[model samples]
Target chain A: MDVIAGLGQGFLVALDPINLLYCFIGVFIGTLVGVLPGIGPVSAMSLLLPVTLSGTPESGIIMMAGIYYGSMYGGSTTAVLVNIPGEAASVVTCIDGHEMAKRGRAGPALGIAALGSFVAGTFSIVALMLVAPALSRVAVAFGPPEYFSLMVLGLSILSFLTQGSMAKALLMAAVGVVIGLIGLDQINAMPRLTFDRLELVDGIGLIPVVMGLFGVAEILTNIEQQIRRDIVQSRIGSLWPSKEDLKASAGPVARGTVLGFLLGILPGGGAVISSFASYAIEKKLSRTPERFGKGAIEGVAGPESANNAAAGGAFIPLMTLGIPPNVVMALLLGAFVIHGLQPGPLMMSQNPQIFWGIVASMYVGNIMLLVLNMPLIGMWVQVLKAPYKILFPLILMFCIVGVFASGNAVFDVFVMIGTGVLGYLMRKFGYEAAPLVLAFVLGPMLENNLRKSLILSEGTFDIFVVRPISLVCLLIAAALLIAPLLPALRKKREKVALDATD
Target chain B: MMLRRAEFWGGLFWLAIGAFVAWQGWLLELGTLREPGSGFVFFWLGLIIVAFATSIAIGGLRGEGPLLGDLWRGARWRNVLLVVLALIAFGFMFERLGFVICSLALLLFLMTVVDPVRPTISIPVSLIAAVGVWYVLEKMLLVQLPKGTWVEDFIPF
Candidate 1:
């Protein structure tokens, strides 16, 4: 009843003409970005933030939110067609999606991806409406100890699941924690690593570092080798899937939806990890495992559903607690603050208009994305027509100019250049930089909560165990960390490790 | 095999970087707890990075996997070098020549050098893209861009 009432309020927010306009614009821009390589939703959101801020808080937040989930639908387009993942989450799609493309079944692959995303996205939002408040109620009981324990759990999951050597992920996560500790110490005014620079007083800018590593870096890596694969197959047929395809995909997509939704609620392993996990699970469950990677419709269907479900599932943490589970969520947190709405339990009761409005707008946004992505598939394919020789120089130049324009400071440009170089090398070296970037954003929040928890408990470590919720999070995280070390899990891990290294 | 020297050398290079960052930490004044300082986190994190760097180096030495040769087949050094040099030049010239002129020049250089596209096509496109992007950013977007050397005199916008 409450969910229905809150959704009713959301409709009022979504229908406003100005809000609707921005929602349309957000999904439009999101598709454009999703169509392009190297410009993920995070970069698109951050780049447009300055422009979006000029509007009323609702417009800005709604539009920014639109860009976030809308891109998920758009990302799989390229993954299914040309095998180039439009964003990181869509990477798993290419493994089977492109195989389908190769075997003249491109239509089915894209059809399933589009349909699966739509279903998962809608279901997830409904789940969001139902689950968020319940989680918030549970969250309200948490204190500093619980928050600290929760962060530890988050970091531990990242350390364990991050796609590289365990040691590297741990090291990068630690570095992220350290980087978060930069600027003025929040507890006291003492400078720690400012190096006597005035700019260091505020520490590092989130916008700049994130833009540099992920945005600028991505552009540099991609521009050099912008190969254009033929996305449109010669004999493209019916857009709708066959009954066999649907039946085969139904079970996998259902399993993926459940798995991704569950995993999405967990910090650190949200959308991307869920997408990968879904692929592995679908493969494991397949009757003909040998057919798993070779144009299997379930391959595209399951991961697409999982990732979309994860996108919906991600709202659980952001709405329930003020904490953002990932970088995209972090950007959304900034949007919430911009809108004069704090994202916590208070948000539901205090600014039901804002809270419900954003939720309602997302429904509008999801419909808008589905409507935009399907018929426009032909138009999006034309995006590939923009010659890389022309497109890259312009995009790369924009990156250069964008970094400089943000502050008009030479140092920032230098930082972008350094990150570009670092990012390129990291890509070349087979090291994943996304985990580092994610850790970098989450590190500060974890630190503040950790310190607060410790100070509140007066250094009594038992605070975590005393709280039932925190205890559950800690136990889960601990089990995850230890489980990989057990002989059975280790054997599987070693095989994956060996294959990946080769 | 030593033919995959890039990976072995790359591993060593990262190890050096870990060491350098660790040294930078040592020079800073780590703040105390209750307001634990910035340097404190960096110092410890640097140590942790070095630990991992050492592990990677050991792995490389043990020949744990594929060599750089396998990965380097499609790699293009000319394009890589051109882009890197352009970026470094962009950074140094960003403030002096202004964002428009320096950035456009950088873009033009990249377009000409990296891809096999003709300058007849590339040059005008890059210039138009530069001028067009600058105009939209400054005029429509209301973003205050650098008044570059070329445009700073009369048509600054």
Candidate 2:
């Protein structure tokens, strides 16, 4: 009854013309960036972070949220037609989606993808609506130790999931925390790393750092390589799938939705991982696994559904626990912070309008994506035809403009450049930036929680262990940290990474 | 061999950073456990970084990674260098030249020099984008953008 009432109130806010327009703009831009490979949601969100300052918090957050899930819908278009994953989440789609296109089944492939995404996207929103409230109630009981340990676990899970060297990922996480701590110390008024510069007094802005690392660094990396696009020339005959295709897709979509929602709730698990896992699971379950990568509609259906569902599920932590589960959520958290609103246990009660409005907007946005994607497939394909040589410069210009507009300071632009170079180098050296960015956002919170817990416990470390939630979190984190040292587990971790690349 | 290994150099760079951070933490004064100071976390993080850095450097020393040159082998590294230099120049001139002039120059340089899109497309696209963006930001969004501090006195808005 309460849920229905809250949703009723939520729709009242979402249906407002201003919010509706912002939602449309968000999903539209979301799809655009998702269709383009060089820029992802992280870059897009950071680039637009400053723009949010001009609107009501709900409008800004609704737009930011729209971009995320909307990208999940848009990514499959490129993956099916051009054999390039529009975004990282769509990487697996290329294997089967492109094959389906090559076999002159492009229409069915795209049709199923959109259908599966709609089903999954809608399911996840309902689930998020149901799950987030109960979870927030549980989160309300959490103390400083629990919060600290949970953050530690979140960082550990991210580091554990990172490809290549765990050591490098951990080091990056450490560096991120250090960078995050650069400004004024929250506990004490003293600045530890500011070096007496006035700019350092406030610390580095998240927008500049994010744009530098994801936006500028991506352009730098892409321009150094020769990019190729091969759009399918065959006619896309129909937008609806055949009866057989729909029958084949129904199970995978269902399974993918469930699996993605469960995984999405876990910190560090997100769209990319969910999609890959769904593909692997569907392949294992298929009667003829040999057809896994050969125009199988299940292959198209499952992963696409999973990524979209995961995107929705990812919100539970951020909206309830005030912890960003991944880099994209971290950016959303940045948006929330900029708007002077904290998204946590009390948010639903304290800011029910903002909370329910965002939830209601997702429903509206998902429908918008379906309507937009099915009819405008050709438009997205045309967008893909734009040359990279032309695109990169414009992208670079936006990066500069975005960074400058973010802080209105030239120093931030310089910071973006410095981090861009560093990010490019880190990529070459095999370090994942996701863990670093996540940690950078989590660092200050982690420090504050730890200090608060100490003050509460009179400096006894036992406080962390005495608390059941904290103990469990710490133990799990410890196991993940220690797992890489075990040879068998190490091989398993490597296999997962290898599978992702495949 | 260690010097040639990419991991060794990367690890070494982080190691210096770790040491510097630890030194900074120490300088900031580590309060006791009962009343944790600002630097307590920094100090521990620094040590943790140093530990990880040492392990990475040791991995490199054991001859277990790619060579340094292999990172840039057969790559268009010149493009990367040019782009970096261009961005640095943009950063320096952004406020001085203002958004319109600076963005136009950047778009032109990148399209022409860095990757070289034809001037026909480049000039028009550059002009439209720079002016369009400047108008959107300054007028529509009401966000103030620099109008070339050096030329602002001469220009009539």
Best by TM-score: 2
lDDT of 1 by residue, A1-502 (tens): 3888989988998999999999999988887777787788887787666666568777887888788777887888888777888877788888888898888887788788888988888888888888887887887877876776777687777667665566666656666666665677676666766778887676665556666777867766666564767675655456678999999999888888888888888877687777888888889988898987787888899999998899888878888887677778877886776556788766788778777888899889888887887678888888856777777777677666666555557676676677667767777676666556666766667666766665566666677788887899899878867866698976766665453233
DockQ for the candidates, in order: 0.46, 0.87
For model 1, give the TM-score of chain B.
0.73
The Cα RMSD in angstroms, rounded to one decimal, for candidate 2 relative to the true structure is: 0.9
Error of 2 at A448 (Å): 0.3
Q: Find the candidate with the highest DockQ and give its number.
A: 2
Tell me which residue pairs clash in candidate 1. A192-B38
Model 1 bad stretches (over 4 Å): A223-228, A284-291, A337-342, A494-502, B1-43, B65-74, B149-151
Q: Which stretches of candidate 2 lie over 4 Å from their true place?
A: none
Given the true complex, what DockQ would model 2 score?
0.87
Query: Weakest 10 consecutive residues, lDDT, candidate 1 chain A?
Result: A493-502
